[model samples]
Target: MKAFIVYCHPSENSFTRHIRDAFIQGVTDAGHECVISDLYRMDFQADMTEAEYLRDAHYRTTPDVAADVRAEQEKINASDAIVFIYPVFWSEAPAKLVGWFDRVWSYGFAYGDRTMKTLNKGLILCSAGNPIDYLEETGILDSMKKVMLGDRLTGRVKQAEFVVFDSTSRENPLREENWDKNLKAVYEKGKSLFAAK
Candidate 1:
């Protein structure tokens, strides 16, 4: 299967990077083609401008936005699966990833009247500093459900899996083995979903 991985970490050596790499490797090892969108390396702009909003309003697509939107759409359209890798900042995705949603997943592209009938197939790989239980107990998961699932991401993807890791452990828990296990679980989940049809 073809897969797109949107990575949104700012630091190269961060735990987020490790988790992202592990997930990528898992998908690749499963014999899937991987397309990565490294937002930080690309220096993607997050804030939507009045001009941009106007373009969206008028459907005057920029050549650059048009090309990128096409590329992203192509990946989504061609792929049998999709993945998002990022670190949670303030309980949400980074500015660049959010910007990606604004720019790439524009109206008529990711959603429109036709979208209520069809959705893409994909998964999400998110690594956070806090523990999974903490995030769940504190309503972070609920917020994500509302934003990524209940809101924009809803009806866009037929299926999605959320992977959260505890990075703030006093003892470094992001060891090689732990990473392997984490990524394996994600891969297994994807495999099950992809093979269901």
Candidate 2:
């Protein structure tokens, strides 16, 4: 299987980076090919220009889409699965990723007369500062899943999942305590990414 990983993070000195690496390691170990888009490293333009917005707003596919967005769409069509790795901010994905959806999921590509392929899987792995119980209790986890899986990835992938490693705040002792365990789980997720299908 080929997995296109969209990783968003501002720094390498983060557990999120380690999770991404571990997931990649497991993917390779499973004998699968993977492509990555390090949004921050690539300095991906998340915000759409006025022209781009107008094109989408008007549902015009006449003017060619931006080369960068086209490239991202191409990647989606080429891959069998898509994985998003990032941190949860304000109960949502980082603004850059939010922008990624705004731009990459262009009107014609991700919707109307879409050329985008329906992939085998779509997975989201995000870290949160709050504990899992708290997130669940507050319905934040469900909301996140609904937004990512029910909305963004809906109809785009055959299967989808949202996993969050919580209690990862720098101030939380569980952050250090669960580091290895969390990474192991991430690796296992990668190794088993294609197992169900």
Candidate 3:
């Protein structure tokens, strides 16, 4: 299987980057192909232009999709699965990633008269500053899942999963304690992503 990873992180000096690397290594080790879009490195334009907003809002199917969005759509079509790696901010994915969905999931592509492929899997691996229990207790985790899996990824993939590596705040002592364990889990997830299918 080929996995297209959409990695969104502002800096390389972060745990999210390490998680991304480990996941890729496991994927390659498992004899699967992996393609990556390092959004920050690529300086991808996430904000939608007025024309793009108009096109989507008006439900126009014309080939007016921007080059960048078209390129992202092409990547999805060319892959067997899609993976997203990022850090959760304010109980949500970073603004950049949110904007990515806004533009890339165009009306004629991800919805309406769709041209996008329904992939085998869609996986979201995000890091959070709070503990899992806290996130769960506050219903933040469920909300995140609902948005990512229940909404954005709905009907777009055969199966989808939302996994968060929590208690990752720099000030948290558990951050160092769980670092290796978290990476191991993500790596294993990448390795076994396509095992069932």
Decide which is better by lDDT, 2 or 3. Answer: 2
lDDT of each: 0.69, 0.95, 0.94
Cα lDDT, model 1, residue 96: 85
Structure candidate 3, residue pairs in collision: none
In the order shown, the candidates' Cα RMSDs to the true structure are 3.3, 0.8, 0.9
lDDT (tens digit, per residue) of candidate 3 on 82-170: 99999998998888889999999999899998999999999999999999999999999999999999999999999999999999999
Against the hidden true structure, what lDDT does model 1 obtain?
0.69
The superposed Cα distance between candidate 2 and the true structure at residue 41, in angstroms, equals 0.6
TM-score against native, each model: 0.81, 0.98, 0.98
Compared with the true structure, what per-residue lDDT tens digits does model 2 show for residues 65-162? 99999999999999999999999999999999999999999988999999899999999999999999999999999999999999999999999999
Residue lDDT tens for model 1, 25-107: 66666666777878889776767767667767776544335556567767667666667778788899887888888877765
In model 1, residue pairs whose N, Cα or C atoms come closer than 3 Å (at least 3 residues apart or on different chains), thus clashing, are none
